[model samples]
Target: MPQPRSTRIAVIGDIHNHWNAQDHLALKSLNADLALFVGDFGNEAVEVVRQISTLDLPIATTFGNHDAWYTATPWGRKRCPYDRDKEDWVKQQMALLDHADTGYRHQDFDTVSVVGGRPFSWGGPEWRFTDFYGEWFGVHNFEESAQRIQEAANAAAHDTLIFLGHNGPTGLGKEPEDTCGKDWRPIGGDYGDPDLAAAIAAVKASGKSVPLVAFGHMHHSLRHTKEVQRTRLCIENGTVYLNAACVPRIMDTEIGTQRNFSVVTLQENQVTEVNLVWVDEGLAIASTECLYTTMKVTEHSASV
Candidate 1:
């Protein structure tokens, strides 16, 4: 008999409260072993968890800037008042966010485990831009985020797969437009950090095989997948990176484009395949253009 297929991981990016038909379709069709969410599930962590749990698959998540809005204690919840009717609606939709903090303490964050005989791990709390959202909702700085990544990496066993953060790995695959040109104006240079870039480079230089590094922070840079250095930046590496932002295409419009997610399948320490599902168009098989099937290290004698 043929060998049974290895585990498949479904990865979703930035579901910013536009969860609806397309979202449901993607979830139902993917049929993944576990659903990895790259954060931004909106202020209602409860609802995000509830809706996602319906898939009946294990979930791993990180916090996005928007998700950090609900850090206040119960009494403080009243400070950010909402319309009674709308508040009632939100309350009824889901209740998982109410326990998100406790859940994080117990479940998600920097860690590692073996799935289908493949080691997998992730880390995040990507840079928090402002306190306008909430104190607990933002990461103090990029350095802190990178440090958490390093900690997770150190904890991972050899031959393990590491998913970096909710944000892309600094320079790789990041677009100047997404970072500095969102509002049709030149903000500055690329939005990614140089330090994060160094960290990823170090991982590549470690001589250990890391196949994927999925991420999602900048929404506009979600179309094409790219390969950077020795690692595939899409889903093929199991160490591949992606930006699964689920924001509406246009403000105030219910319909949108590129409503998508990824499915990763691994077998015997190698990434066999990656499937990208466009909510409306079914599955698009991704090509391994820049994927690294092997890594080479050179040793040289020191010259006098």
Candidate 2:
């Protein structure tokens, strides 16, 4: 019998309410079986979701801090002023696409199975403030979110497990360039979420092999320093962790500024290729790098 084909997945994140013509062009190029967005759809959440839905490809997403704030009571209106109305509309649109805003959800397509959610992380000081606001607006807490992830992992029915999240699991590194990197020069420490890290650890400990873990939220901040500025994809203990937070700042995008995203190929339940791509403002491919490839699933972790 002829062998089944590989599955292509597109990983993108930090869409801060901007998906222009160029972005559309870039997405079309991937021709992926599915696209996973890690969150932060911004105030124009409704419009953006509608636009993306037009692509007709299945999309899976987790809400980010910015996304939570869009529906946050007094805080949301004070920050963006679009609030409630737009948030409601966005939820309706998400339902149409058969996507849950957050929590444990799974899907099986061909040879792959995916579990995705926006974890409630006990983040840094600023994030705590956002968490409090999130609570008031009906967002899940750390413990609750952790339990969901664990259950999802336990119930997964496929060998090729793909985990999707907004904030990455902790312990990747302490360097600013790492997935959960932090600069504690003055105070000194890691900035990743302990809850997320612990949950992931438990999942791995359960013996379920997670081939790819896609996340965003820890973006490279150009304002502070340029030390950690680029797409980060690392393989550790047979699991590939990808940090998809491409936007380095909150400012409006410029003409020549490039957007970061990734394309992953899985064949016969093993990851065969990963491409870290950057698209220019004109919808042209600015750069593309095959970060990793393996003929067999037994290959060890390697950083590129």
TM-score of each: 0.57, 0.77
lDDT for 100 (candidate 2): 34
Where does candidate 2 stray beyond 4 Å?
A: 1-4, 72-77, 83-97, 100-102, 119-141, 183-188, 227-231, 248-259, 279-284, 295-304
- Go through the candidates in order and give each one's C-alpha lDDT: 0.45, 0.64
Give one digit per residue, the lDDT tens place, for model 1 in 132-190: 21243233554543454444454555545545345554444323333211212342234
lDDT per residue for candidate 2 within 1-304, as digits (tens), equals: 9875888988887888877666777787778788887877665366676666666676666666665454444566566654455356445545644553334556655565677654323244233544443553343455655666677766767756787777777677665555566643453245566556666778778776677888888775533466545336777777778777767422234556776778888776657787777767666767776767775322223353
Q: Return the top candidate by lDDT.
A: 2
Poorest 10 consecutive residues of model 2 by lDDT? 295-304
